[model samples]
Target: MSTAVHTMNATALKGRARDLGRRVTVLMLLPSTLWFLLLLVTPLLIILVFSFGERSAVGGYAGGLTLANYLNLGSRAAAFSNTLLLAPMGTLVCLLAAYPLAYFLAVKVQRSRSLLLTLVIVPFWTSFLIRTYAWIFILSGKGLPAMLASLGLENVRLINTPSAVLIGIVYGYLPLMVFPIYVSLEKLDKRLLEASQDLGASAFEGFRRITLPLSAPGVITGVMLVFILLMGEFLIPAILGGGKVFFVGNALVDLFLQSRNWPFGSAVAMALVAIMLVVIGLYLKLVARHGGRPGEGAL
Candidate 1:
Protein backbone atom coordinates (compact mmCIF):
# COMPACT_ATOMS: atom_id res chain seq x y z
CA MET A 1 0.00 0.00 0.00
CA SER A 2 2.81 2.37 0.88
CA THR A 3 4.60 1.56 -2.44
CA ALA A 4 1.41 2.25 -4.36
CA VAL A 5 0.87 5.51 -2.52
CA HIS A 6 4.47 6.67 -3.34
CA THR A 7 4.05 5.88 -7.04
CA MET A 8 0.71 7.71 -7.20
CA ASN A 9 2.27 10.75 -5.53
CA ALA A 10 5.10 10.76 -8.09
CA THR A 11 2.60 10.71 -10.95
CA ALA A 12 0.59 13.51 -9.38
CA LEU A 13 3.75 15.60 -8.94
CA LYS A 14 4.60 15.23 -12.63
CA GLY A 15 1.14 16.30 -13.67
CA ARG A 16 1.28 19.34 -11.37
CA ALA A 17 4.75 20.25 -12.67
CA ARG A 18 3.51 20.36 -16.26
CA ASP A 19 0.57 22.56 -15.29
CA LEU A 20 2.78 24.90 -13.25
CA GLY A 21 5.24 25.27 -16.12
CA ARG A 22 2.47 26.36 -18.47
CA ARG A 23 1.20 28.89 -15.93
CA VAL A 24 4.74 30.21 -15.34
CA THR A 25 5.28 30.70 -19.06
CA VAL A 26 2.07 32.71 -19.37
CA LEU A 27 2.89 34.78 -16.26
CA MET A 28 6.32 35.71 -17.56
CA LEU A 29 4.97 36.80 -20.94
CA LEU A 30 1.98 38.78 -19.67
CA PRO A 31 3.76 41.95 -18.53
CA SER A 32 6.11 42.15 -21.50
CA THR A 33 3.28 41.50 -23.99
CA LEU A 34 1.27 44.31 -22.44
CA TRP A 35 4.30 46.65 -22.31
CA PHE A 36 5.21 46.03 -25.94
CA LEU A 37 1.71 46.64 -27.19
CA LEU A 38 1.03 49.73 -25.05
CA LEU A 39 4.38 51.45 -24.71
CA LEU A 40 6.73 50.36 -27.47
CA VAL A 41 4.68 49.03 -30.37
CA THR A 42 2.00 51.70 -30.23
CA PRO A 43 4.40 54.64 -30.02
CA LEU A 44 6.63 53.21 -32.73
CA LEU A 45 3.68 52.85 -35.08
CA ILE A 46 2.63 56.44 -34.37
CA ILE A 47 6.14 57.70 -35.07
CA LEU A 48 6.34 55.63 -38.24
CA VAL A 49 3.02 56.97 -39.54
CA PHE A 50 4.01 60.54 -38.67
CA SER A 51 7.38 60.18 -40.36
CA PHE A 52 5.77 59.55 -43.76
CA GLY A 53 3.19 62.30 -43.51
CA GLU A 54 3.05 66.07 -43.99
CA ARG A 55 2.39 68.94 -41.55
CA SER A 56 -0.82 70.93 -41.43
CA ALA A 57 -0.89 74.75 -41.87
CA VAL A 58 -2.06 75.07 -38.26
CA GLY A 59 0.85 72.89 -37.07
CA GLY A 60 0.34 69.13 -36.43
CA TYR A 61 0.53 65.88 -38.35
CA ALA A 62 -1.35 66.12 -41.64
CA GLY A 63 -2.58 63.06 -43.51
CA GLY A 64 -0.35 62.98 -46.62
CA LEU A 65 2.94 61.31 -47.56
CA THR A 66 5.86 63.56 -48.46
CA LEU A 67 9.65 63.38 -48.70
CA ALA A 68 10.19 67.13 -48.19
CA ASN A 69 10.05 66.78 -44.42
CA TYR A 70 12.89 64.28 -44.49
CA LEU A 71 14.85 66.42 -47.00
CA ASN A 72 14.83 69.33 -44.54
CA LEU A 73 16.69 67.17 -42.01
CA GLY A 74 20.06 68.85 -42.66
CA SER A 75 18.92 72.09 -41.03
CA ARG A 76 19.52 70.68 -37.56
CA ALA A 77 23.12 69.65 -38.15
CA ALA A 78 24.44 71.44 -35.07
CA ALA A 79 21.99 69.64 -32.78
CA PHE A 80 23.09 66.32 -34.21
CA SER A 81 26.73 67.29 -33.90
CA ASN A 82 26.36 68.24 -30.22
CA THR A 83 24.46 65.03 -29.40
CA LEU A 84 27.00 62.86 -31.24
CA LEU A 85 29.90 64.54 -29.51
CA LEU A 86 28.57 64.77 -25.96
CA ALA A 87 26.64 61.52 -25.58
CA PRO A 88 29.68 59.25 -25.82
CA MET A 89 31.85 61.58 -23.79
CA GLY A 90 29.25 61.75 -21.02
CA THR A 91 28.89 57.96 -21.02
CA LEU A 92 32.67 57.54 -20.86
CA VAL A 93 32.91 59.97 -17.97
CA CYS A 94 30.15 58.16 -16.11
CA LEU A 95 31.94 54.82 -16.67
CA LEU A 96 35.28 56.15 -15.49
CA ALA A 97 33.65 57.64 -12.40
CA ALA A 98 31.37 54.70 -11.70
CA TYR A 99 33.95 51.91 -12.17
CA PRO A 100 36.08 53.12 -9.29
CA LEU A 101 33.09 53.46 -6.94
CA ALA A 102 31.74 50.08 -7.97
CA TYR A 103 35.16 48.48 -7.61
CA PHE A 104 35.67 49.89 -4.15
CA LEU A 105 32.22 48.88 -3.06
CA ALA A 106 32.52 45.37 -4.47
CA VAL A 107 36.16 44.37 -3.99
CA LYS A 108 37.74 46.49 -1.27
CA VAL A 109 35.18 47.40 1.38
CA GLN A 110 33.59 44.21 2.60
CA ARG A 111 31.79 45.67 5.60
CA SER A 112 28.41 47.33 5.22
CA ARG A 113 28.25 46.63 1.50
CA SER A 114 24.49 46.94 1.67
CA LEU A 115 24.79 50.34 3.33
CA LEU A 116 27.25 51.54 0.72
CA LEU A 117 25.10 50.29 -2.13
CA THR A 118 22.14 52.01 -0.55
CA LEU A 119 24.13 55.23 -0.53
CA VAL A 120 24.82 54.78 -4.23
CA ILE A 121 21.14 54.16 -4.93
CA VAL A 122 19.64 56.70 -2.54
CA PRO A 123 19.95 59.57 -4.99
CA PHE A 124 17.77 57.69 -7.47
CA TRP A 125 14.91 57.75 -4.97
CA THR A 126 14.24 61.35 -5.96
CA SER A 127 12.97 62.43 -9.34
CA PHE A 128 15.68 63.31 -11.86
CA LEU A 129 14.03 66.67 -12.44
CA ILE A 130 14.25 67.54 -8.77
CA ARG A 131 17.87 66.49 -8.71
CA THR A 132 18.68 68.63 -11.73
CA TYR A 133 17.17 71.60 -9.93
CA ALA A 134 19.58 71.06 -7.03
CA TRP A 135 22.42 71.07 -9.55
CA ILE A 136 21.16 74.39 -10.92
CA PHE A 137 21.80 76.06 -7.60
CA ILE A 138 25.09 74.25 -7.03
CA LEU A 139 26.41 75.39 -10.39
CA SER A 140 25.09 78.89 -10.02
CA GLY A 141 27.49 81.81 -9.55
CA LYS A 142 26.49 82.15 -5.93
CA GLY A 143 27.12 78.48 -5.14
CA LEU A 144 30.61 77.16 -6.04
CA PRO A 145 31.76 80.47 -7.40
CA ALA A 146 30.88 82.22 -4.16
CA MET A 147 32.90 79.70 -2.17
CA LEU A 148 35.84 79.97 -4.59
CA ALA A 149 35.87 83.77 -4.50
CA SER A 150 36.33 83.68 -0.72
CA LEU A 151 39.47 81.60 -1.31
CA GLY A 152 40.97 84.32 -3.63
CA LEU A 153 39.71 82.94 -6.95
CA GLU A 154 38.04 86.08 -8.29
CA ASN A 155 35.81 84.75 -11.05
CA VAL A 156 34.26 81.40 -11.95
CA ARG A 157 31.47 80.68 -14.36
CA LEU A 158 30.25 77.16 -13.81
CA ILE A 159 26.62 77.89 -14.43
CA ASN A 160 25.41 77.75 -18.02
CA THR A 161 28.55 76.06 -19.32
CA PRO A 162 29.31 72.79 -21.05
CA SER A 163 31.23 71.64 -17.99
CA ALA A 164 28.12 72.23 -15.90
CA VAL A 165 26.09 70.13 -18.30
CA LEU A 166 28.70 67.36 -18.08
CA ILE A 167 28.61 67.51 -14.30
CA GLY A 168 24.82 67.27 -14.33
CA ILE A 169 24.94 64.30 -16.68
CA VAL A 170 27.47 62.48 -14.51
CA TYR A 171 25.63 63.23 -11.29
CA GLY A 172 22.23 62.25 -12.62
CA TYR A 173 23.44 59.05 -14.28
CA LEU A 174 26.10 57.89 -11.82
CA PRO A 175 23.71 55.57 -9.97
CA LEU A 176 22.64 54.04 -13.28
CA MET A 177 26.30 53.65 -14.16
CA VAL A 178 27.28 52.08 -10.84
CA PHE A 179 24.63 49.39 -10.31
CA PRO A 180 25.30 47.30 -13.44
CA ILE A 181 29.06 47.25 -12.91
CA TYR A 182 28.53 46.45 -9.23
CA VAL A 183 26.24 43.52 -10.05
CA SER A 184 28.79 42.17 -12.52
CA LEU A 185 31.65 42.66 -10.09
CA GLU A 186 29.79 41.24 -7.11
CA LYS A 187 28.70 38.15 -9.05
CA LEU A 188 32.32 37.60 -10.22
CA ASP A 189 33.87 34.32 -9.15
CA LYS A 190 36.17 35.06 -6.23
CA ARG A 191 37.88 31.72 -6.80
CA LEU A 192 39.12 33.03 -10.15
CA LEU A 193 41.06 35.77 -8.37
CA GLU A 194 42.36 33.24 -5.85
CA ALA A 195 43.39 30.93 -8.69
CA SER A 196 45.15 33.71 -10.56
CA GLN A 197 47.06 34.80 -7.45
CA ASP A 198 47.74 31.18 -6.52
CA LEU A 199 49.38 30.77 -9.93
CA GLY A 200 51.81 33.64 -9.16
CA ALA A 201 49.93 36.46 -10.93
CA SER A 202 50.55 39.88 -9.40
CA ALA A 203 47.63 41.90 -7.99
CA PHE A 204 47.37 44.28 -10.95
CA GLU A 205 47.90 41.49 -13.43
CA GLY A 206 45.25 39.38 -11.76
CA PHE A 207 42.79 42.26 -12.02
CA ARG A 208 43.66 42.84 -15.65
CA ARG A 209 43.37 39.17 -16.59
CA ILE A 210 40.41 38.30 -14.41
CA THR A 211 38.34 41.15 -12.98
CA LEU A 212 38.40 43.46 -16.00
CA PRO A 213 37.47 40.76 -18.50
CA LEU A 214 34.58 39.49 -16.39
CA SER A 215 33.14 42.97 -15.84
CA ALA A 216 32.96 43.83 -19.56
CA PRO A 217 29.27 42.95 -19.72
CA GLY A 218 28.44 45.47 -17.01
CA VAL A 219 30.65 48.03 -18.72
CA ILE A 220 28.85 47.47 -22.01
CA THR A 221 25.42 47.64 -20.37
CA GLY A 222 26.15 50.88 -18.48
CA VAL A 223 27.66 52.52 -21.54
CA MET A 224 24.70 51.55 -23.71
CA LEU A 225 22.19 52.82 -21.13
CA VAL A 226 23.80 56.21 -20.38
CA PHE A 227 24.73 56.88 -24.00
CA ILE A 228 21.19 56.24 -25.26
CA LEU A 229 19.51 58.56 -22.74
CA LEU A 230 22.12 61.31 -23.19
CA MET A 231 21.26 61.43 -26.90
CA GLY A 232 17.71 62.56 -26.14
CA GLU A 233 18.63 64.73 -23.15
CA PHE A 234 17.09 68.16 -23.44
CA LEU A 235 16.58 69.24 -19.83
CA ILE A 236 20.28 68.95 -18.97
CA PRO A 237 21.43 70.99 -21.95
CA ALA A 238 18.58 73.44 -21.61
CA ILE A 239 19.20 74.08 -17.90
CA LEU A 240 22.97 73.68 -17.59
CA GLY A 241 23.82 74.93 -21.10
CA GLY A 242 21.19 77.70 -20.79
CA GLY A 243 20.09 77.37 -24.44
CA LYS A 244 23.64 77.64 -25.82
CA VAL A 245 24.16 73.93 -26.37
CA PHE A 246 21.48 72.76 -28.80
CA PHE A 247 20.68 69.05 -28.89
CA VAL A 248 18.30 67.12 -31.13
CA GLY A 249 16.06 66.91 -28.08
CA ASN A 250 15.90 70.69 -27.87
CA ALA A 251 15.20 70.86 -31.61
CA LEU A 252 12.35 68.42 -31.23
CA VAL A 253 10.90 70.50 -28.42
CA ASP A 254 11.08 73.69 -30.46
CA LEU A 255 9.75 72.12 -33.63
CA PHE A 256 6.74 70.72 -31.82
CA LEU A 257 5.90 73.30 -29.18
CA GLN A 258 7.27 76.56 -30.57
CA SER A 259 7.33 76.21 -34.36
CA ARG A 260 4.25 73.96 -34.50
CA ASN A 261 5.83 72.01 -37.37
CA TRP A 262 4.67 68.52 -36.46
CA PRO A 263 5.56 66.71 -39.71
CA PHE A 264 9.10 68.13 -39.85
CA GLY A 265 9.49 67.51 -36.15
CA SER A 266 8.35 63.95 -36.65
CA ALA A 267 10.88 63.56 -39.42
CA VAL A 268 13.60 64.93 -37.19
CA ALA A 269 12.42 62.65 -34.38
CA MET A 270 12.61 59.70 -36.78
CA ALA A 271 16.09 60.78 -37.86
CA LEU A 272 17.14 61.05 -34.23
CA VAL A 273 15.85 57.53 -33.64
CA ALA A 274 17.84 56.30 -36.65
CA ILE A 275 20.99 57.99 -35.36
CA MET A 276 20.48 56.48 -31.90
CA LEU A 277 20.01 53.05 -33.46
CA VAL A 278 23.24 53.38 -35.43
CA VAL A 279 25.17 54.57 -32.41
CA ILE A 280 23.81 51.74 -30.27
CA GLY A 281 24.63 49.21 -33.03
CA LEU A 282 28.21 50.46 -33.25
CA TYR A 283 28.51 50.32 -29.45
CA LEU A 284 27.21 46.74 -29.36
CA LYS A 285 29.60 45.71 -32.14
CA LEU A 286 32.51 47.18 -30.23
CA VAL A 287 31.39 45.44 -27.06
CA ALA A 288 30.95 42.12 -28.85
CA ARG A 289 34.41 42.43 -30.40
CA HIS A 290 36.25 43.22 -27.17
CA GLY A 291 33.87 41.62 -24.70
CA GLY A 292 34.19 38.02 -25.79
CA ARG A 293 36.91 35.77 -24.38
CA PRO A 294 37.98 32.53 -26.08
CA GLY A 295 36.59 30.30 -23.33
CA GLU A 296 33.94 32.52 -21.75
CA GLY A 297 30.31 33.09 -22.76
CA ALA A 298 29.14 36.56 -23.83
CA LEU A 299 26.85 38.07 -21.20
Candidate 2:
Protein backbone atom coordinates (compact mmCIF):
# COMPACT_ATOMS: atom_id res chain seq x y z
CA MET A 1 0.00 0.00 0.00
CA SER A 2 2.86 2.37 0.85
CA THR A 3 4.63 1.54 -2.51
CA ALA A 4 1.41 2.24 -4.43
CA VAL A 5 1.11 5.66 -2.77
CA HIS A 6 4.75 6.45 -3.64
CA THR A 7 4.16 5.54 -7.31
CA MET A 8 1.06 7.77 -7.45
CA ASN A 9 3.02 10.65 -5.96
CA ALA A 10 5.81 10.23 -8.55
CA THR A 11 3.24 10.18 -11.38
CA ALA A 12 1.68 13.42 -10.12
CA LEU A 13 5.15 14.99 -9.89
CA LYS A 14 5.90 13.98 -13.49
CA GLY A 15 2.63 15.48 -14.67
CA ARG A 16 3.40 18.73 -12.87
CA ALA A 17 6.88 18.83 -14.44
CA ARG A 18 5.35 18.43 -17.91
CA ASP A 19 2.92 21.24 -17.16
CA LEU A 20 5.79 23.44 -16.02
CA GLY A 21 7.74 22.65 -19.20
CA ARG A 22 4.71 23.55 -21.32
CA ARG A 23 4.35 26.83 -19.48
CA VAL A 24 8.04 27.60 -19.98
CA THR A 25 7.78 26.94 -23.70
CA VAL A 26 4.74 29.22 -23.96
CA LEU A 27 6.63 31.93 -22.07
CA MET A 28 9.64 31.59 -24.35
CA LEU A 29 7.50 31.94 -27.48
CA LEU A 30 5.32 34.74 -26.08
CA PRO A 31 7.52 37.68 -27.05
CA SER A 32 8.02 36.63 -30.67
CA THR A 33 4.34 35.81 -31.01
CA LEU A 34 3.37 39.21 -29.61
CA TRP A 35 5.89 40.94 -31.86
CA PHE A 36 4.54 39.23 -34.95
CA LEU A 37 1.00 40.18 -34.01
CA LEU A 38 1.89 43.75 -33.18
CA LEU A 39 4.06 44.40 -36.19
CA LEU A 40 3.63 42.05 -39.16
CA VAL A 41 0.06 40.78 -38.75
CA THR A 42 -1.37 44.13 -37.69
CA PRO A 43 0.27 46.02 -40.56
CA LEU A 44 -0.81 43.43 -43.12
CA LEU A 45 -4.37 43.54 -41.78
CA ILE A 46 -4.39 47.33 -42.06
CA ILE A 47 -3.08 47.18 -45.59
CA LEU A 48 -5.69 44.59 -46.58
CA VAL A 49 -8.47 46.71 -45.14
CA PHE A 50 -7.18 49.81 -46.86
CA SER A 51 -6.89 47.96 -50.16
CA PHE A 52 -10.67 47.59 -50.43
CA GLY A 53 -11.40 51.16 -49.37
CA GLU A 54 -11.40 54.39 -51.40
CA ARG A 55 -8.66 56.94 -51.59
CA SER A 56 -9.32 60.37 -50.05
CA ALA A 57 -9.75 63.28 -52.50
CA VAL A 58 -6.45 64.82 -51.43
CA GLY A 59 -4.69 61.50 -50.63
CA GLY A 60 -4.63 58.61 -48.10
CA TYR A 61 -7.31 56.02 -47.36
CA ALA A 62 -11.00 56.93 -47.30
CA GLY A 63 -13.59 54.74 -45.62
CA GLY A 64 -16.12 52.51 -47.52
CA LEU A 65 -15.37 49.55 -49.78
CA THR A 66 -14.79 49.52 -53.53
CA LEU A 67 -12.78 47.61 -56.19
CA ALA A 68 -11.72 50.76 -58.10
CA ASN A 69 -8.18 50.58 -56.71
CA TYR A 70 -7.80 46.96 -57.90
CA LEU A 71 -9.21 47.82 -61.33
CA ASN A 72 -6.69 50.62 -61.62
CA LEU A 73 -3.90 48.04 -61.46
CA GLY A 74 -4.12 47.94 -65.24
CA SER A 75 -2.49 51.38 -65.30
CA ARG A 76 0.71 49.88 -63.93
CA ALA A 77 0.76 46.99 -66.41
CA ALA A 78 4.10 48.10 -67.79
CA ALA A 79 5.66 47.92 -64.35
CA PHE A 80 4.28 44.40 -63.91
CA SER A 81 5.63 43.37 -67.28
CA ASN A 82 9.07 44.74 -66.51
CA THR A 83 9.19 43.08 -63.10
CA LEU A 84 8.02 39.68 -64.39
CA LEU A 85 10.43 39.68 -67.30
CA LEU A 86 13.52 41.17 -65.70
CA ALA A 87 13.26 39.34 -62.38
CA PRO A 88 13.35 35.94 -64.06
CA MET A 89 16.04 37.07 -66.47
CA GLY A 90 18.13 38.39 -63.61
CA THR A 91 17.71 35.14 -61.66
CA LEU A 92 18.80 33.12 -64.69
CA VAL A 93 21.86 35.32 -65.17
CA CYS A 94 22.84 35.00 -61.52
CA LEU A 95 22.44 31.22 -61.75
CA LEU A 96 24.59 30.98 -64.89
CA ALA A 97 27.38 33.05 -63.35
CA ALA A 98 27.14 31.58 -59.83
CA TYR A 99 26.97 27.84 -60.63
CA PRO A 100 30.42 27.55 -62.20
CA LEU A 101 32.12 29.53 -59.44
CA ALA A 102 30.30 27.58 -56.74
CA TYR A 103 31.16 24.27 -58.43
CA PHE A 104 34.82 25.20 -58.70
CA LEU A 105 34.90 26.30 -55.08
CA ALA A 106 33.18 23.16 -53.83
CA VAL A 107 34.59 20.45 -56.13
CA LYS A 108 37.94 21.69 -57.42
CA VAL A 109 39.53 24.06 -54.91
CA GLN A 110 41.67 22.02 -52.54
CA ARG A 111 43.41 24.79 -50.56
CA SER A 112 42.26 28.09 -49.05
CA ARG A 113 38.59 27.24 -49.52
CA SER A 114 37.64 29.35 -46.50
CA LEU A 115 39.66 32.27 -47.84
CA LEU A 116 37.92 32.09 -51.20
CA LEU A 117 34.54 31.89 -49.51
CA THR A 118 35.49 34.94 -47.46
CA LEU A 119 36.40 36.79 -50.65
CA VAL A 120 32.95 36.02 -52.04
CA ILE A 121 31.34 37.39 -48.87
CA VAL A 122 33.62 40.38 -48.29
CA PRO A 123 31.67 42.53 -50.75
CA PHE A 124 28.58 42.11 -48.59
CA TRP A 125 30.28 43.92 -45.72
CA THR A 126 30.00 47.18 -47.69
CA SER A 127 26.67 48.97 -48.04
CA PHE A 128 24.57 47.76 -51.00
CA LEU A 129 23.59 51.32 -51.92
CA ILE A 130 27.24 52.37 -52.02
CA ARG A 131 28.11 49.41 -54.23
CA THR A 132 25.23 50.14 -56.61
CA TYR A 133 26.15 53.86 -56.74
CA ALA A 134 29.69 52.87 -57.75
CA TRP A 135 28.24 50.94 -60.71
CA ILE A 136 26.81 54.24 -62.01
CA PHE A 137 30.35 55.56 -62.55
CA ILE A 138 31.66 52.17 -63.76
CA LEU A 139 29.08 51.98 -66.54
CA SER A 140 29.26 55.66 -67.48
CA GLY A 141 30.67 56.80 -70.86
CA LYS A 142 34.13 57.26 -69.34
CA GLY A 143 34.13 53.76 -67.88
CA LEU A 144 33.74 50.33 -69.58
CA PRO A 145 32.08 51.96 -72.58
CA ALA A 146 35.14 54.05 -73.27
CA MET A 147 37.53 51.11 -72.82
CA LEU A 148 35.45 49.06 -75.25
CA ALA A 149 35.19 51.99 -77.64
CA SER A 150 39.00 52.25 -77.67
CA LEU A 151 39.06 48.52 -78.50
CA GLY A 152 37.15 49.32 -81.74
CA LEU A 153 33.65 48.84 -80.36
CA GLU A 154 31.78 52.14 -80.89
CA ASN A 155 28.74 53.73 -79.18
CA VAL A 156 28.36 51.02 -76.55
CA ARG A 157 25.80 52.56 -74.21
CA LEU A 158 25.44 50.47 -71.03
CA ILE A 159 24.41 52.98 -68.37
CA ASN A 160 20.68 53.68 -67.91
CA THR A 161 19.71 50.57 -69.86
CA PRO A 162 18.15 47.17 -69.08
CA SER A 163 21.60 45.62 -69.60
CA ALA A 164 23.09 47.82 -66.90
CA VAL A 165 20.33 46.82 -64.46
CA LEU A 166 20.98 43.15 -65.23
CA ILE A 167 24.68 43.61 -64.59
CA GLY A 168 23.94 45.12 -61.18
CA ILE A 169 21.40 42.41 -60.36
CA VAL A 170 23.82 39.58 -61.21
CA TYR A 171 26.63 41.18 -59.21
CA GLY A 172 24.47 41.72 -56.14
CA TYR A 173 22.62 38.37 -56.05
CA LEU A 174 25.38 36.00 -57.24
CA PRO A 175 26.51 35.29 -53.69
CA LEU A 176 23.00 34.21 -52.69
CA MET A 177 22.88 31.74 -55.59
CA VAL A 178 26.45 30.55 -55.00
CA PHE A 179 26.33 29.57 -51.36
CA PRO A 180 23.31 27.22 -51.52
CA ILE A 181 24.71 25.33 -54.51
CA TYR A 182 28.16 25.28 -52.93
CA VAL A 183 26.72 23.75 -49.77
CA SER A 184 24.95 21.11 -51.82
CA LEU A 185 28.07 20.24 -53.82
CA GLU A 186 30.38 20.35 -50.81
CA LYS A 187 28.20 17.87 -48.95
CA LEU A 188 28.01 15.43 -51.92
CA ASP A 189 29.52 11.99 -51.54
CA LYS A 190 32.61 11.35 -53.69
CA ARG A 191 32.18 7.61 -53.31
CA LEU A 192 29.08 7.76 -55.46
CA LEU A 193 31.05 9.42 -58.26
CA GLU A 194 33.83 6.84 -57.97
CA ALA A 195 31.32 3.98 -58.00
CA SER A 196 29.64 5.39 -61.09
CA GLN A 197 33.00 5.60 -62.82
CA ASP A 198 33.76 2.02 -61.81
CA LEU A 199 30.50 1.05 -63.48
CA GLY A 200 31.77 2.60 -66.75
CA ALA A 201 29.80 5.82 -66.43
CA SER A 202 31.37 8.88 -68.03
CA ALA A 203 31.85 12.08 -65.98
CA PHE A 204 28.93 13.72 -67.72
CA GLU A 205 26.72 10.70 -67.18
CA GLY A 206 27.58 10.60 -63.50
CA PHE A 207 26.85 14.29 -63.13
CA ARG A 208 23.55 14.07 -64.97
CA ARG A 209 22.30 11.02 -63.09
CA ILE A 210 23.64 11.62 -59.58
CA THR A 211 24.97 15.10 -59.00
CA LEU A 212 22.22 17.09 -60.71
CA PRO A 213 19.31 15.46 -58.93
CA LEU A 214 21.01 15.74 -55.55
CA SER A 215 21.94 19.36 -56.05
CA ALA A 216 18.46 20.33 -57.23
CA PRO A 217 17.29 21.38 -53.78
CA GLY A 218 20.05 23.94 -53.51
CA VAL A 219 19.45 25.12 -57.06
CA ILE A 220 15.79 25.63 -56.33
CA THR A 221 16.63 27.47 -53.12
CA GLY A 222 19.02 29.79 -54.93
CA VAL A 223 16.53 30.42 -57.71
CA MET A 224 13.73 31.11 -55.26
CA LEU A 225 15.82 33.52 -53.19
CA VAL A 226 17.14 35.44 -56.17
CA PHE A 227 13.81 35.47 -57.97
CA ILE A 228 11.88 36.76 -54.94
CA LEU A 229 14.33 39.59 -54.27
CA LEU A 230 14.49 40.51 -57.96
CA MET A 231 10.70 40.72 -58.04
CA GLY A 232 10.81 43.57 -55.52
CA GLU A 233 14.00 45.26 -56.70
CA PHE A 234 13.85 49.02 -57.27
CA LEU A 235 17.24 50.56 -56.53
CA ILE A 236 19.32 49.04 -59.35
CA PRO A 237 16.60 49.74 -61.90
CA ALA A 238 16.16 53.26 -60.53
CA ILE A 239 19.86 54.11 -60.60
CA LEU A 240 20.98 52.08 -63.62
CA GLY A 241 17.85 52.25 -65.77
CA GLY A 242 17.39 55.92 -64.85
CA GLY A 243 13.65 55.36 -64.36
CA LYS A 244 13.30 53.88 -67.86
CA VAL A 245 12.96 50.30 -66.59
CA PHE A 246 10.37 50.50 -63.85
CA PHE A 247 9.40 47.51 -61.65
CA VAL A 248 6.52 46.87 -59.26
CA GLY A 249 8.70 48.12 -56.40
CA ASN A 250 9.31 51.36 -58.25
CA ALA A 251 5.58 51.66 -58.86
CA LEU A 252 4.89 51.13 -55.16
CA VAL A 253 7.40 53.83 -54.23
CA ASP A 254 5.91 56.25 -56.72
CA LEU A 255 2.38 55.56 -55.49
CA PHE A 256 3.17 55.93 -51.80
CA LEU A 257 5.74 58.67 -51.76
CA GLN A 258 5.36 60.51 -55.06
CA SER A 259 1.64 60.28 -55.79
CA ARG A 260 0.49 59.83 -52.18
CA ASN A 261 -2.20 57.43 -53.42
CA TRP A 262 -2.42 55.41 -50.22
CA PRO A 263 -5.49 53.29 -51.06
CA PHE A 264 -4.16 52.48 -54.53
CA GLY A 265 -0.73 51.74 -53.11
CA SER A 266 -2.21 49.44 -50.49
CA ALA A 267 -4.12 47.60 -53.20
CA VAL A 268 -0.95 47.21 -55.24
CA ALA A 269 1.02 46.08 -52.21
CA MET A 270 -1.65 43.51 -51.29
CA ALA A 271 -1.70 42.20 -54.83
CA LEU A 272 2.05 41.87 -54.82
CA VAL A 273 1.91 39.95 -51.55
CA ALA A 274 -0.82 37.69 -52.92
CA ILE A 275 1.16 36.95 -56.07
CA MET A 276 4.23 36.11 -54.02
CA LEU A 277 2.23 33.74 -51.84
CA VAL A 278 0.84 31.95 -54.87
CA VAL A 279 4.25 31.62 -56.46
CA ILE A 280 5.76 30.35 -53.23
CA GLY A 281 2.97 27.81 -52.86
CA LEU A 282 3.34 26.55 -56.40
CA TYR A 283 7.11 26.31 -56.07
CA LEU A 284 6.75 24.38 -52.83
CA LYS A 285 4.36 21.94 -54.52
CA LEU A 286 6.78 21.51 -57.40
CA VAL A 287 9.64 20.84 -55.00
CA ALA A 288 7.45 18.36 -53.14
CA ARG A 289 6.77 16.51 -56.38
CA HIS A 290 10.54 16.34 -56.97
CA GLY A 291 11.09 15.26 -53.33
CA GLY A 292 13.53 18.12 -52.85
CA ARG A 293 13.83 19.98 -49.56
CA PRO A 294 15.36 23.42 -49.78
CA GLY A 295 18.78 23.77 -48.02
CA GLU A 296 18.99 19.99 -47.47
CA GLY A 297 22.08 19.78 -49.72
CA ALA A 298 23.20 16.72 -51.69
CA LEU A 299 22.91 13.40 -49.90
What would the per-residue lDDT of candidate 2 be over residues 1-299, giving only the tens digit for each residue? 99999999999999999999999999999999999999999999999998898878888877788999999999999888888888889999999998889889998898889999999999899999999999999999999999999999999999989899989999999999999999998998889889889989899888877787777878888999999999899999999989898989999999999888888899988888888788878978977876555323322
lDDT of 1 by residue, 36-145 (tens): 89998798788878878887888888879888889988899988888888888899999999999999998888889989989888888898889998988987888998
Question: What would the TM-score be for candidate 1 when compared with the true structure?
Answer: 0.85
Give the TM-score of each candidate: 0.85, 0.89
Kindly report which residue pairs in candidate 1 clash with one another: none
Give the true-structure RMSD of model 1: 4.8
Which predicted model would earn the best lDDT?
Answer: 2
Clashes of each: 0, 0
Worst 10 residues of 1 by lDDT: 290-299
lDDT of 2: 0.89
For model 2, state the Cα shift of residue 150 in Å.
3.1
- Candidate 2, position 225, lDDT: 96
